[model samples]
Target: MPKARRKPEALDGQHFEVVVVGAGMAGLASALRLAMFGKSVLLLEKHYVVGGLNSFFARGGRKFDVGLHAVTNFPPKGSGKASPLIRLCRQLRIPFEELALSPQSFSRIAFPDVDLKFDNEFGFFISEVERLFPREQDRFQKLLRTMEAFDAYSPEVAGDVSARSILGEHLQEPLLIEILLCPTCYYGSAVENDIDFASFVMLFDAIFRQGLARPLDGIRRFLNPILKRYEELGGKRRMNLGVKHFVTKNDIVERIELDNGEIIFADHVISTCGVVETERMLSSASQDENADDVSRISILESIAVFKKQPADFGWEETIVFYNDADVFRYERPDELTDPRSGVICIPNNYRYPNGEQMAEGQLRVTCLANYEKWVALDENSYRSQKEICRKAMLEVALGYLPNGNSMAKELEERTELLDIFSPRTIKKFTGHLDGALYGSPRKSRNGSTRFGNLYLAGADQGYVGIVGAMLGGVAVANNRILRGD
Candidate 1:
C-alpha cells in the first residue's frame, strides 16, 4: 500500500520557486515535474479533491469518473521511446506497468448509412476506410502522410487553420470527412462545426494512431499513482485553497492572493485553470482581449447503471460514436442538447486481466450542449430538463447499437440508476467560463502571457485529452521554467 499524502505546511507568507494553479492533470504534472527537479513548488486547488475535470465523485457508495471516456494515446507494450505515454512515464519516473491499463475490444463510428469499426491497429481502421469509402482510399492514405509530417507542437504553427478546409483539399467524399471528424471533434475540438487542423492532427494521432485504453479501476487508478509519486518527491499541495488574484507589477506576478485572503509568492506561476480564467485573475486591465475566445461548446452526459453487463444485452463495443443525421453537426444546439449526434461509451467492454469484470453494466451517452441555455434555467426547471434530456439522449443513442431498438424496453427496465451532468455542472466544478468542454477556441500554444512569469497549461495550452494535458504541463515546465526561457 502507498503512503498517505502528507498535509502541506502553512502557505501564507511563504515563497516558492514555482506555484501551479488548479490541480488538474496539467497542474499536477507540472508541480510534480518541478518538484523532481528539486524546486520548491506549491500546488493549489479550490476543490477539496484533485483531478479537476478528470476527477471522480461518489454517490450512494459507488464512484464514477467525470471526464474519462477512455484514456487516449495507448501504445502497445515495448512500443519504444517514441510513444508519448512512454516518454511521459519516463519524465515523471513512474513505472508503465503500474497503471494496469486494459485495452478496448474494439470501437465503432456509426452513421445513418455506414458503420466503421476500429481497434488498436491502424491497419484495421485503414481497411475499414477502404471497405466503406473505396474511392477515397488512396486520398485517405495521402492525408495520413500529411498528418504524420505536420508539426502540431511547434509554437509558431497556426492553430486556427480550419481542419475542414484541409480535409476538403485531401478527400472528395464529404460523408467520410464528417465521419472522421465526428469522433475527433467530440473528443477534443473547442471550435464549433470544425476543429482546427493543428488540433486535428494531434487528436488524430492520439485517438486513431496511438489508440485508447483505460486503467483497470478507472481514473483514480491512474491518478493516485501520480499523486503518490508527487508526494514521495516532497511536493507541497493544499486542497480547498485557490488563487483569487494575481497581484502583478510591471507585467510580472509579484504575489498571489488565495481565496481565503491569504497571500503567497512565487518566482513563476503555472495555471491549468484555462486561458480566460487565468487572464481574469490578473491585476492588469490589458488581458481582456482574449475574453471573446472563451469556448461556447459544452456537453451533457447521461450515465445509466444497469443490472447486468452491456455484453449480456449484446452491446459489446467499447465506445460508439454515432450520428443520426446525414451531416454530423458538432456544435452547441439552440436548445439544451443535440441528441442527433453523440457518443455512447460502455465501460464494461474492456478486456481486464484474468477475466475480471465490473459487477454492474454502465452506459454513458454524451451530446453537444448549449451552456447559456442550460445555465439560464432555475433549479426546478434544471432538474426537470435533466430527466427529459436524459431519456431523449439514451433513446437516440440506443438506436445506433446492434439490435438496440429491440433491447431498449428491456435495457430501460434493467436500469438500476441514472445520473446526468450538464454544462452548468462543468462550469460550477471546473470553473471554465461558459462551461466550455475544451476551453477557448483560440489557444495559447506557447503557454505565454503578457506577464512574463505566468504561463498556461491544460486545455487552453492547445493540447487535448488526459495524455495531451500531461504532456502540455511537462513541456511548459521543461521549456520555460527549467530552461529559464
Candidate 2:
C-alpha cells in the first residue's frame, strides 16, 4: 500500500483529470471511482494517515478505533445484491469478502421503564417492541410499510422533512419515538433536535434492513483494502498536504493552491471538507456571498481500557444507549455532558478473526460537548476540565450497569488505562473548525458548488456515518463526473 510522495518542486505545474481534497472515506471513495473510470486523480490530505474521523490511533502498544464504533449498513455476504457498499466494491473490482464483517449479537437501548435489546434483524427488533407494547404492533407495522416506501431517498421525498415530525406521524408514545431515534440520531445528526428525513431513512435502512456489523480486524482492515484498491487503480494520493485556496475563472475552478504554495490544475475538483471550510478556501471572485453558515455540535469522548470484558460483570451488551429519561435530545449542551443521554461502546465485544478474543477490553463513552467552551481554556485548564468531565461521565455510566452500586468498584479494580479526548483535541487532529462531529446543519446539497467544475462530498454533501458518507462520494462521482448528469 506504499504510495510515492510528490516533491514540492515536482508539484509546481502538475495537472490531473480530477483533484480531490481530503483522504477520508468520502474522498478516498471518489478518488477510487475516478481512477476506476480511467481518470487521473490526485487525492490530497493534511494528515499523515487516512481514514479521517473514522480512523484509528495507537497508544501503549494497543490500537483503538477513533470514530467508528460499528458500521450500520452491512449487506450480508453473497446476497448478490446491489447495496451502496456492494456497488462500490464491484465498481472498484474489490472482493466484498475482504471486509470481513460480522453481525453484532445485540445492543441495548435502556430506558427507566424498559430496556430493548435489538438484534441486527428487523423482525427481531419489531417483535421485541410488539411484545413490550402489545397495542403498538399495528403502529409499528405501519411504520415499517412507510419506511419501505420511502427507502429510496429521492430529492422530493427527502426535502427538508423533520425526523421528529416523521416519527410523530407514526407513533404517539414519547418513549417509543425516543427509543427509535436515540441510536441513529446521536450517531450522526446535524440539526438541533430533528434530523432530516433522508438521514432518518438512511439510518433506518442501514440499521433495520441491512443491520450493523464490525470489521473483524477493526476499521483499518475495512478501509485499508479500499485504499489499496484506490492505489492499484492508478489513483495518486499526497499526504501531509492541504488545499489553501481555489483559483477560479469565469465561475469555474481551474486550479488549486496548496498550503506550500504549489498550484495544480484540475479538470474537476471534489472536496470532502465541510461547507464552511470550502467557502473559506474560495477566493473573493468565486466566493458565494450568500453562502450559509451551518450550526455544528462537538463531542467529548473517553476511552477506558479494562483488564477484563464487561461480560464478566454481567454487562454483555456491545453498545448501550442510556439516558435518565426516555428523551434523547441531540444538541450541543452548555455543560460538558447532559448526564441524561450518551452512548457507551464496547469494541472488544466484536467477534475477532478466527474466534479470537482480545486480551483486554476497551470501552468508549461519548456525549455532546460545547466546542467553544473547550477552546476558551488554556492547555493546563483544558486537561483539568477533561479529567473533571471524565469523572462525572464515569459516575453517570455506572448507573447503567447491572449492579449499579458495585459496578464502579468492579470497573476500577480492573481498569488498565483511561484516556480522554476533548473537542479541542478533535479540532486539532481532524482540522474541523469547531470539532463538529458531522459538520454543519445544512440542507443536503447535490455535491455541486457555485463553480461548475467544483463539487462536494462527505459532511458537506449532507451524508453522515461511514456508509452514508462513502455512498455520497460515489453518488457525486457517478452522477456528476461519470454520467455527467
Candidate 3:
C-alpha cells in the first residue's frame, strides 16, 4: 500500500536520495525505477493529476485526454523485445499485458493531391509509399537502409542535424518528402518546418516502423498501474506541489525550494520539465542564459463529442494528417491558428478487444498556432476566439473526410459537447513557455546540466511519446543517478 500524502509542512526538512520534478511519464518511471532499487525518491507534480502532457480531465461527466493522440512505438506481442515500449515495460517491471493496448485500425497522410494510408504493418506502409510515389521506391528503400544504420541514441552525436537535407539527398520527389515529414513533424519535431535527423530517425522508427496504439480505457488506465506499482514498491509522490527553485552550490544542486517555500535536500535531482522551463527554475543568477532556446512551436486543439461513431459517417481511419497545399507548412502561424494543415483523430476508430467501442464518438483536431497571439487576448476574447477557431478548424478538417460536406451538418447537430484549447491553455496547465508542445529546439541527449547531481529528462531529454519519455527517465536514473556516469 502507498503511504498517505505528505503535507508541505511534513516534508519541509525531509531529505531524499533522489528528487524527481514533474510526475509525467518520465518522472514516474524514474522514481519507480529508483525505488525498486531501494533508493528513497520523492516525486513532485504541480498539477492535481499525473501524465503531464499526456494527462486527462473530466468534463461534463466524460473523460478527455489532453495530449495523447496515440501511444507511439507500439510493437506486437512477443515481438519487438528490443523496442522502446517493450524495453520501458521491462525496465519498469510492468507487465506488457497490463497496458491493455489496442492497435490503431489505420491512419493516413492526406494531401491535396495524394493520400497514403498505413497501419501496424511496416510492409503495408512501404507498399503504400511505393504505390503513391512509384518512381521513388528505390530511393525510399535506400533512405530506410541509411536510417536503419544510424545510431540515433548516441549521446556523443549532434542531434540538431537537418533531416530535410538528408531526405533531399535520398529522394527527389518534393511531395514524397513533404508527405513523410508531415506525420513526423506533427508527432515530435520541435524545430520549425524541419526536424533534427536524429529525432526524425527515432520518430520514423517509432511511428512508421513500430506503429501506434492506445489503451482502450484512455491514459489513466495505463498510468494507474504504473502509479500503483511505484507506490507498492515504497516510492513516494506528492501531487499539486512543485519545485519553486533549485539552490545550487559549486555546480551541484544542493537544495530544493518547494512552491510553498519549504526547503528540502536530495543527493540527486531529475527534472522532467522542458529545457527552458527547468533552466528558469534554477535559483542561480545565470538562470536566463538559455532563455532564448525556448521553443516557438505550439498548438491549438479542439475536441468534439457526438452521439454516433465516426465510422457511421464514413470516417474509418484512426487518425488523419492533412495538408491543403502541395507544400506542407509546419511553422508557427502568425494568426491564432493555421488550420490549413492539421491532424484529425477519431478515438473510437481503434480496434478494441471483444468488439468494444467508446460510448460516443470523439474527434480531435490539432493545428499549429501562435502562442503570443493567443496569450495577448483578453478573457472574453480568448473564450470567443476559441469558439471561432473551433468552427474554423473543424470546417477545414472536414474537407479531408469522405462525403465531408454532407457530414458536417450531421456532425454539428449530433455534437453533444465541444471544447477548444489554445496555446494559452497549454502554458497555464503544463507551465511550458509559449506552450511549446515538444519542448526546446535544442535537446540534451545525455540528460546533463552544468550541475553535477542535476539532470534533465522527458521531452528535452530528446525523447518523444509516452513510452519514449519513460525510457528516457529510466535511462537517466540508471546511467546518471544509480550508475553515477
Candidate 4:
C-alpha cells in the first residue's frame, strides 16, 4: 500500500511568516523553531519522507543510522550547561539522549601488534595519547591547545587551512599522523584535499567528545517525534514535491515553484536543499559560472544501505572495518584512489527499540566517488554505472573482511546505494552545484556562507552527523530567524 498523504489539520496562513523549502532535518528543525515563535510556517520537502539525510531503516533484527554512523560532541542537558542543539531540542520538544561510550569507544588505533585506544574527554584524550607515547606528551598537549583554540576560532577566520596544514605546522609524528587519517573515511577526504584546520577540528572534537549514540531506535525513532511535534505546532509539510524554481518578489524569495506545478507563496524561505541547488533555483546564469562553483566542494561521500540482521552492541562496533593487512598500503594506489570504507553494525539492545532485533542484519559502506565521474555520464549510462560502482565497492569489501566473497554477495543482494545526491543528482533532485553535502565548506571563500538574510543548515555546514546537522538546523533558526529578529 502507498503511504498516505499526511496533510496538516490546519494550514490557514495565506502568506506565512516563514516559508521553508526542503523539509530535510535542517528545514524541519528550522520550521519547528520558527513556528514556536508564533510564525506561520510552511515546510516543503522534495522527497517522500521528512528526515532528509538524517534517517534510518529496520533490517535484520536491528535499525541502522543510514548515513550518520554516530554523532558525538553534542552537549547533554543538565543543571548549568548544554550544547546549542540540546537547548533547541528541549525548547522544541525534540527528544534526544546523551550517550557515553566505554571511554575507549572511538579511534582505537591498531597497527599490526600494537593498539592505542582513544577514549574519554579532551583532557583524558590527551592523557591517553601521552600514556601510549610518552615522548609525544608535550607535543600532544600542543595539539590539544590547538584544538581548543581552533574550536573558538571559526572557519571565517581560518583561511585555506587543510587538515595537513595544521598538522604539518604543529605535530609531526608517524603514529599521530596515522591517527589523524584514521577517520578520513568519514568525509572520504584525501590528505591532499585541503581539509583546513577548522574542518579537521570539527571532526576531531566530535569523535573525542560525545562518543556515539545509536539514535534511541535508529534515526526514525529520533525524528518521528520531532516531525509529530512539528504538526502539533501548526507547521505544514508536503513530500514528493520537487522544488524547481524560486519566485523572488521585493528582493526576497516570496514563493517556491514545484515540479508538480504547485506554487507556494510565503514570507520567508529557508533552503535545506544545498548550495548548488539553492543557487540553481535563484540563479539566472550560464554554464560557466555554475561550473566554477562546482569545484568548491571538498568531498563527496556515497553511502550504501542494506537489509540484514543488525550487528549487536559490544560486538565489532557499528563502524567496523576488517581491513586486510595485505590490501592496505599507506601510499595511495590508483585502484584504491576512491577509498572504500567499512560500517558493520547490528541494532543491539543499546540502539534498538524495546522489541527490535537483528534478524536481518544491516550494513552501510561509504566511499568518496567523484561527482564528475557520475555527472559526466548520461542518464542510462549512469544507471548502469551505479551497479558497476556497487560491484567495485563489494570487491573493496572483500579486501576488508575475511569471508569477503560471501559477505559481499549477501550485501550485494540486499544493499542499496543511498548517496544519489552526488553532484548531478543534487542537480536533478535537490538542484545543487556539485551535490555538495554541506554547502561550500570552503574556509577560503564564503567562509561561513553568511549571505545577507540567506543561511545554510544541513550536512553543508558545521559538522557532518546527526548532532551536527541538528545543530546546523538550530543555527539557521537562531542566526537567521530567532536571534532578536
Residues 188-304 of candidate 2: C-alpha lDDT, one tens digit per residue: 777777787778877877776677788756889867888888888878999999989887777787678899999888878898887777877887634443344545577898998
* Residue pairs with backbone overlap in model 1: none
Query: Taking the tens digit of each residue's C-alpha lDDT, what string does model 1 give over 1-485?
Result: 11111222434437787889989998988888999888888899888878888999886667999889998889866688767888888888888888888889999999988999999888888899999999998899999999989988676778889999999999999999999899999999999889999888888888888888888689998789889988988889999888889998777888888999888888788998898888888866465657678898899999999898899888889999999876889887999998889999998898889999988999999999999999899999999999999989988999988888899998889988888899988886688988999989978888988788889999997888888888889999998888843
Better of 1 and 3 by lDDT: 3
TM-score of each: 0.96, 0.92, 0.96, 0.75
Model 2 Cα RMSD, 1 decimal: 4.2
Q: Write the per-residue lDDT of candidate 3 for residues 245-308, one digit (tens) a residue.
A: 9998778887899999888888788998888888888996565677778888899999999999
**Ranking 2 against 4 by lDDT, winner:** 2
Best by lDDT: 3
For each candidate in turn, give its C-alpha RMSD to the true structure in angstroms: 4.4, 4.2, 3.7, 7.0
**Candidate scoring better on lDDT of 1 and 4:** 1
lDDT of predicted model 2: 0.77
Model 4: residues with Cα > 4 Å off, grouped in runs: 1-14, 56-65, 74-85, 95-116, 119-128, 131-134, 152-160, 184-192, 295-315, 321-357, 375-433, 443-453
* Residue-level error in angstroms, candidate 4, position 267: 2.3
- Which window of ten consecutive residues has the lowest lDDT sum in model 3? 1-10
Quote the RMSD, in angstroms, for model 3.
3.7
For candidate 1, the lDDT comes to: 0.87
Candidate 3 ranges beyond 4 A from true positions: 1-13, 286-288
